[model samples]
Target: MSIDLKTIKHISKLSRISVDEKRAEKLAGDLNSIFDFIEKLNELKTDNVEPLTSVAETTLKLRPDEVKSKNIREQIVKNSPQDNEDYFVVPKVIE
Candidate 1:
């Protein structure tokens, strides 16, 4: 697709950017170049090519899931200023 000054102005307005006529012309040229490059890339045949998720072939190492500590809620809750059997009580700040 071709990019003109009008298109550049419209894009600048939508993006909340201010652009002068000279800058707008430059942007139009730059956008046209980018679109041309994309068009060239689209012309390449890739029907047999597979999509790659990662460049590396190695699988991620995972650690075994196991409990490392006993239930310590009662011991920890003893240090709190105010706590019930299962929760900590805090001052109400909101209505």
Candidate 2:
């Protein structure tokens, strides 16, 4: 596929980019080259190729989940300016 000046201007508008006529014409040529390369790639045969999720062969090591700290809610809540038995109180802002 070939990119024209109008298409380049449209792309610039959609991307919120400012481009002059000279730059847009240059960008149109650049985009046409990119599409031509993609079209060339599409002509290649890769029916036997397998999709790859990762290039490296490795597994993640995970540790067993366990609680390392005891309950300290009462100790921490003592520092709060306003807190109830099991919750913190804050001023309401909504009407």
lDDT tens readout by residue for model 2, 1-95: 78898888898999999999999988988888999999999999999998778899678999999988789888877776686777767778798
Q: Which ranges in model 2 have alpha carbons more than 4 Å from their true place? A: 14-16, 75-81, 90-95
lDDT of 2: 0.87
Instruction: Give the clashing residue pairs of candidate 1, or none.
Output: none
Model 2's number of clashes is 0
Q: What is the TM-score of each candidate against the true structure?
A: 0.74, 0.69
Tens digit of per-residue lDDT, candidate 1, span 4-86: 99999998999999999999999999999999999999999999999888999789999999988799889888877786787
lDDT minimum window of 10 residues, candidate 1: 79-88
**Stretches > 4 Å off in candidate 1:** 74-82, 90-95
In model 2, state the lDDT of residue 95. Answer: 85
